[model samples]
Target: MTADPKSSPLFSFGVPALFVWLWSTGFIGAKYGLPYAEPFTLLLIRMLLTLVLLGVLARLLKARWPGWRGAGHLAVTGLLVHGCYLGGVYYAIQGGMPSGIISLIVGLQPLVTSAVAIMVLNEKVSVRQWLGLVLGLVGVCLVLLEKFGLNDTSGGFPAWTLIWAALSLGGISLGTVYQKRRGTGADLVSGTIIQYMAAASFFAVGAFAFETREVEWALPLVLSMAWLVFGVSIGAILLLMWLIRRGAASQVASLFYLVPPVTALEAFILFDERLGLLAMAGGCLSIAGVAMVVMRPPPVNKQ
Candidate 1:
């Protein structure tokens, strides 16, 4: 009999690695696409495209739809996760907050998620996990310290933009805990479609109210949009939902700490960006911290 691929070590490692890689590309995609469209407009388009694709997939797979109560939970998650989180991110970037600063701000997610999970889900976090969370934050700060400049106006973004970043941090943190608490066990495809529908509605309202809704239709924008819709939205999000279903919320949130480091490496390879020694060390620390947080303790031997 064939072994279940999902039970293999490779599958376990590969899924998280793939998720981090895909999630990191979102920063690149936002940078690429934002020049051609306002944040809301760009996100609205992406969400609509994602919804269409997921809708088709759900139909083909005969995916089950959750009851209204379960769907309401999914919609709340969608608003918090996709709507507020992505909206804040894209808005901050569009308003000229450097992606590094934004990433650093949101990198606090694991800690925030742990706290929320404790209060909301009644999840117990050991002292080791708390240390790991702190270590991860320190590592992310080290990775991004070079990007900070007191004298640079580019670094001195408007106070409102910083609020957006804060909102984003809160959004994703709460959303992660909320998903673990209430959004699990639904059909992944159908649940995501509902989530995207909520997020799309959010973007539609924002786009109509705030943006001119003009799109330049350039090659970079087109490619970035395609990648965000297919790669990040569909692929990474499904993986995230699956991960959240299968793990402790705090452990799952720790995966986000790897994003900035992975994003730095991606920038280096794709854009000739240089990584300093501190950044490399920070990456190592982040990896170690995540390992500490996510690694299961060895089973105790019976006497």
Candidate 2:
């Protein structure tokens, strides 16, 4: 059987790098947009715009809409992946959790996903894969340590907010497995449209109930929202779903280990954030760990 076009070689080498680059910009986008609007408010706008833009693209491409069952599955996955996960992170950050601390906490998603995949998806994980997960985690922690050290967080962050961050990690972890298990064969463009619509509803409720819904309407905020809507939300997510469909859930989750380091680099270039030698070493370790998981040995056939 041939691989789906979405799962072809283009994804093998190029997609991961492009996805990482696009995904990393999400941090930058949040940084730019958050000052102008409340967390849920900002997310609501981004989700709405993402829906509109993707809807247009889906029509232009004449994308096939999933049946009701697939649409429901995708919507639920969207709630977890986009709504709960992003809501937690944004809320935690808005409530004063440092971005570095949040990133470190969320970086644990691979291990969580691996554990869940083992139990729920009945996936067999090798010792090498476990080692890669741990190594990647350690690498991320080291990079965060250099950037944050013990002093990364100040005193005022609420315990509940940290819990929210953890919830975000869980959301994404479970969402990946759910996507793989239930959403493997869905149409990308239309499925994503349903997802954003569902996610937008989630955030819209929060924005209306909890937020004052004020937006500064600054050029920076507008630009950030545009990038997030078209670039990260659409581009990065399509790549993510493609990866999940193409590889093991654990391996797909491992890719997230690259995010913090990549984001660190982006911050360095864009915002002049520090990227010390220790951070570089940690980044290398992260890469090596991802390789171990992603580049598994081919199956040996016994005649």
Residue pair clashes in candidate 2? none
Q: How well does candidate 2 score on lDDT at residue 75? A: 94
Query: Tens-digit lDDT track for model 1 on 1-303?
Result: 999998687987789989999999999999999999999999999999998899899999999999999999999999999999999999998887888889988999999899989998999898888888899888888887753432354447877899899989999999999888899979999999999999999999999998899999999999999999999999999999999999999999999999999998988899888888888898989998998898777799999
Per-residue error at 274 for model 1, in Å? 0.8
TM-score per prediction, in order, is 0.96, 0.94
Query: lDDT tens digits, residues 60-161, model 2?
Result: 999998889999999999998999899988898888888888898889999999999999999999999889889998899889989877364556587888
In model 2, the number of clashes is 0
Worst lDDT 10-window in candidate 1: 146-155
Question: What stretches of model 1 exceed 4 Å from their correct place?
Answer: 1-5, 147-155
Give model 1's clash tally. Answer: 0
As a whole number from 0 to 100, the lDDT of residue 190 in candidate 2 is: 88
